[model samples]
Target: CPPIGLESHRIDDDQLLASSMLRHGLGAQRGRLNMQAGTNEDDFYDGAWCAEDDGRTHWLEGDTRRTTKFTGVITQGRDSQIHEDFVTSFYVGFSNDSQNWVMYSNGYEEMMFYGNVDKDTPVLTEFPEPVVARYIRIYPQRWNGSLCLRLEVLGCPLSSVSSYYAQQNEVTSTDNLDFRHHSYKDMRQLMKVVNEECPTITRIYNIGKSSRGLKIYAMEVSDNPGEHETGEPEFRYTAGLHGNEVLGRELLLLLLQFLCREFQAGNSRVRNLVTQTRIHIVPSLNPDGYELASQAGSELGNWALGHWTEEGYDLFENFPDLASALWAAEERKLVPHKFPNHHIPIPEHYLAEDTMVAVETRAIMAWMDKNPFVLGANLQGGEKLVSYPFDTARPLSETLAAAPRPPDYEDDHPELQETPDHAIFRWLAISYASAHLTMSETFRGGCHTQDVTDAMGIVQGAKWHPRAGSMNDFSYLHTNCLELSVYLGCDKFPHESELQQEWENNKESLLTFMEQVHRGIKGLVRDQQGEPIANATIVVGGINHNVKTAASGDYWRILNPGEYRVWARAEGYNPSVKTCSVFYDIGATQCDFVLARSNWKRIREIMAMNGNRPI
Candidate 1:
């Protein structure tokens, strides 16, 4: 039986995720998690796995000599925390059994193994929900053979750290609201404007929702807008992962407005970018967090606290980590993660994988799966430097830093643990800094006095500061997308008055960053019938990272405009590789590949399946 709080629809049972990214490490306790409410006073049934009785039960201890845990499942009417897949609270209940026994909840999302069952009473905590007791210890004297303890195991099904609150009403009326910063309603209104005014190059849709059921909108700006332009390199610029860092969100909206106005005026630069590039902009991923942050003056006092999700989880750290995800891939006999110094901080709720990945995160992941993105930037604040992976440290005992590699390690096997595309990454990161008016200059970094002197406004991610499950690292490692962490400002939460200046500061850099997407290899992977092969993997000969084609059999890879060998591979099809030279003047080199299916193959198998320091 499934645990009470573990809802069926809430579970992420995506097989593709299970085979690759997620890959079976999470607890897969399925089918209505059996949970008995604590209102029972019946005799205890030393259940083989769990105890279920009719409201009344007792305990007759048989094995008092050997101490072990007694696992039991209990139900709650409706877990205020888990609303669909999103977890909103960490509330649970515990019994007042004078004598103690350890209890534990199987963490499906995170492995939670902390709590003393003996003296720590769940009744003392945020009570009345379901409580979990960990490290329980039932003394020998406490469990005599006739021991009839009426002590109810006010046990929680799984552990979640979110606090409970009545769901906030959805904000609809923007009558008196400030239109300066785009609120959810304001963003939707703007989305409507672009769709109607610049209908040719703009299309908008909601990718998913926030924990509080607020819609997460995505606006796609391209030449064809809705249709996939075959072989065109797609780029994405995401912002507002940290809600308090409002610069990116506001800038993205402005960019959308700018592109619409420019397209109408036939401006060359904006016309070219919108014409050639499929740019998807998600102004805010954390609408709930942003809502909390927007209340900076009223209810929420701390800006830093407002930066996190409603649950207080760092969105960047919530994705599948490089080390763990790689280990999972290797278990499936696929490629292995080269080097990772540390592990992602374990999640608070061992409840379900659903909670491990917030609803916002899941939405973004799903969006990525549908659209094949080549190069992108995650805009953020708190620092003014462009950073490149590997964000996590090297394994040389935490002593050996990146670069100045020990002579023994080869280029592919970097001792300092730089990514396979280290050269390109370095160049890309440097380009962003160089384009900026101030960031490239000295005294530009944040987070500390020393960080102010980052190497030429650009730094190797791990070298600057080690982060285990950052978005930049996850994008490069998993999807093989080239994503740079672009830190736009030092002040995390600037007032609305500063929005114009911040946009001016980042305008050129943002435009130039998207321009680089054009200098790469782009092509289509298709069957003999000229039908598109979606999700086809594109690999460059020397580079470690790879790119996958879009649903239209389209793929794009950015390079420094030079000679290269590119290979296109998909399931049940012979991989196609070709050699080509990219002209210095020509922006995107075309190198389309026509894949032939293996005799005993099904075509859809290949086509079907699909943040950050600054972000």
Candidate 2:
């Protein structure tokens, strides 16, 4: 019989019985199994090897060359001309050499993995934890008439920085190339394939539909798929907002593939990221525009046709004009300390039924309202630098006419508005810029000579070029997510041949930015009874801007290293304050709050009936 197999990896533990091996490298040495083969009387006839059913003493085994880490394994039943036999249950064993071996255990005892029930279908069983071994043997305790198997060891070579890099490093670009950009359908298929291959850590979801009724998809990569975990900071990377700017979309797709592959291969850095952070990647926000852009091919057709949505709206500039509203709120404030810098509400006009806001923009707004995302980056093109919010600043007239403001206010730079989290935002921007291949190069001027040259490869968004209703500003003002506008390069749409280099240029930055989600403080706010309190306001002393806890009672705040007082308060609870010392050497500092319910509940109920709330 032949081996019908899927590639996967796994590890084992101690207490093994004596068993003879068939041979090493069953899948690696031999050619691939007939993936399309069925029980055609000749299926797996010559490809599979079977062990003698001598009282369950005989077993099949293979070698991994050197010491290697395994995550799971894929196995198949046999379908030969003479017989149809398969192992229904089996035990896996691992060893450094061929002599002493450890049985794959469920932490309590040896685990018996289920094999294929039929002859052709493949069964995959992943290990509870990663196993390190060179030799892997299968002990079939139970079989369907006979102990026959075909298998493949799924894993990478030895783990090393250089090897990892070498595995991902692509060939140099040339004029004659076979590369082509993925169409909307191709992108969807690619995402689906990734989700299928790495189902444990990936989830495919649709935020909404495009103007042309195309589903706008977003993929989440996390240890716990589909649901957000408490205390874990949520981060997002969105691209293809302007469909003509294709590099960001390609880079994100590449990133999705890379993360899935590396995580399965037992890459520690990637494993930690997947386990600790909830990452959201929206590869194409404007699928309608992308479809138009992709129709243009690599170097022909209208480049400007897909710069916006099918309805001819710039998605970036289609959000609610919250910048003006924020400015207005600030101007009407009785005191400088009472300025509304965080969680600014959307103006009513933008949410009206007859408004011309793009459907994609509204979907994103609703998405933001649901997820407590702490960090985000919007990938774009036409330059090579990272610009952090506020992307929209107070008008020059207002800056000149307003009364005295806070000390951090920059009257001299009216076009640039600094958030209370400016230092942290700048640090995040620099982290990405410095990690990028050429974004921080001082000698290179800019992608296009006319672009602004920043020594740190970063700038304030409004300072670079103010635009109303920018996504960066919208993200900052309307939600807990602080976002940066990352300009990939000068070319809005480059040839597909350049995608490899483009991915290489942005890979490290993408990984680093996701890792930055852990750099700030995060925790939960609960009442005296230990129940989580939703919508609790968390205010850092001396910073007017504040954040609200999610429905899970968890909150994440990105802060620079410093000692400061943090407070968590609910409407009917006594606010609790604590002093936290954030350090540069560690991940987010944990700061939990336990608020006590106020005794004036009856008074609050009376006030509620009167349509009034206590301060």
Candidate 3:
């Protein structure tokens, strides 16, 4: 069953103002409230309290639990029973105890936030930065009728404290690779400390919060921390889609720590990778589920409890159905030249206002939309193999099925739907599998007796087992990203003592997989005038799929070792073709393109100037 108010967990903006605010962890009615000298705490709710006209010092305080980290406050004026009484303007004060208080200041002056005007509509005010405080005081400076209100505090529990000792020594030390599961808060603190330790090369930011309001954090390590440089490929590794899949998440954290330490110690490979590529690692996407699973511990417990989001949705299958939309277009012959195998827009229905996509899914979709990631992989557990895209087995729509089809369709493999880049995808899968210590073993007695063994430690996702709305398929079809699903091991949540071995087994493979992003051809596309052309299409000769250059006119295409014709096409410019080859040992083949003004476009312009004369 879904939790109370789960239906209202949509985040449309920065401020949550209505009664719906309570659904987003703003629980004021349940907090301890303190009133001014002459006012009763109950008066702020039903009855109205007015400040003296002289205004010496009158306020109301809402104090949350001891460890709550305060982000902001949401306040409702008096209820309709009162005469539209409300605080018009207010100053906020923060305090750990009720004794010492500090006013929220804008450097020099104390900040004043405007409150509600009506009796029902709530108003919100956020702090400049998040403050860990138990008590927050609202001192009203102005009022409509009287300074009367109800209050709600906005924050999650302060997960862990950042200690000086940890930040200075343990954070950047490669010696202390702790082999344990980090709770959501602990993971966040670790990332924070890492960022602090390596401020120049590391960035920590949240994508979005889970249904339970825990942040989904992504840490980026690059030459330039937050900015995406020109011609640099963006690669990401995401883990913890199923909350019980704990190994991947811990491994990612270890990878983060290792990268930080190695780069600081001037490790050439780490420094080169950071300098040339933008690497983003999202350690845990399902923090709420992870919390539940971690609480239940790793000793052969019920594996299904925290496999889904707290809202009872499996995030792996929660993305919008994009594959069907693409197939429908191809079946209808709507594609003019060839089927669009890349950057397929999401279905209109999925983006509709009333759609019920999980918050985590929406956050990641938005994240992908912003980053032109060239390669990615979502790490999972419960298996020990690497799987590539098209993880669905459903038949096409009735309209699509009725159209004329090829004769080979009857003999086609329905279980596996390969992408246009199937060869490269397979190579990618094999790369990870080959690097892992035991993934390639024919039969290591399986995870359990009944467990199935994967041949060569790699397989197409749909062939393994049909599942829809998978992140790998979504990334391949809907964006410029080629993503894979790598199942780490048999146990979804291994015992804590086994973590060190698991890290040793997977560490080299993780680094090797990240290094693979630089294997393909990368270059900039520009016009004859030497101006970079944004949104230029990069098309491989035979492959129908296409990818667009990034905002910086830079593009990256991962290809297997071969010679091929590649074209760069942009509006108002003549297309340019180049032959690029990837070798077995070479890192990346540079293939830059410079397009000229289109002759046909020039003729059209001349004809228009000559009063529609034919060219």
Identify the leading candidate in terms of lDDT.
Answer: 2
Model 3 lDDT at residue 49: 35
Error of 2 at 612 (Å): 12
Q: Candidate 2, residues 1-615: lDDT per residue as tens digits?
A: 011112101111121222432332122222122212222433221334455334676666665445567776667665355657667888888888788989999889999888777666556667778788766777778877556665655544464322343335434533222235788888888999999989999999999999999998999999999998988889999999998788888888888888898899899999999999999999899988888877755333232558889989999878877778777766677323555567777878878988998989999999999899999998987677999877776676555656677888655555567877889898999989999876886554543232364588898877767778988888887798889889887556665645766776787899998888888688899987899999999899887778899999999888888998998988889888899888886489999999988877878778989889554
Separately for all candidates shown, the number of backbone clashes (residues 3 or more apart, or on different chains) is 35, 10, 0
User: Which ranges in model 2 have alpha carbons more than 4 Å from their true place?
Assistant: 1-180, 301-303, 334-339, 397-414, 450-453, 601-615
Which pairs of residues collide in model 2? 1-44, 2-44, 2-48, 8-72, 8-154, 9-71, 9-72, 10-72, 13-102, 13-103
Q: Give a tens-digit lDDT track for model 3, residues 1-615.
A: 010110011111111122222121122221111111112233222322344342625666654434566777655555434267667788888778778989988888999888777655445667778777766677778777755555555666453333453223212222467667899879988899889988999999989889888889999999897898998899999999999898999999988988898899998988888898899999999999988888766532343657899888899888866777677677688763555667877888888877878888899999999998999999998667888877876475576557897777683444345778889998888888898876886454223222243458887778766788888888887888999998887567765655676677787788888888988788999987888899899999877788999998999999888898999999888899989998886378999999988888878889899999765
TM-score of 2: 0.68
- How high is the CA lDDT of each candidate model? 0.57, 0.74, 0.73
Looking at model 3, the pairs that clash are none
TM-score (all chains, Cα) for each model: 0.61, 0.68, 0.67
Q: In angstroms, how far off is 437's CA in candidate 2?
A: 0.9
Worst 10 residues of 1 by lDDT: 15-24
CA displacement after TM-score superposition, residue 367 of candidate 1 (Å): 0.9
Worst 10 residues of 2 by lDDT: 1-10
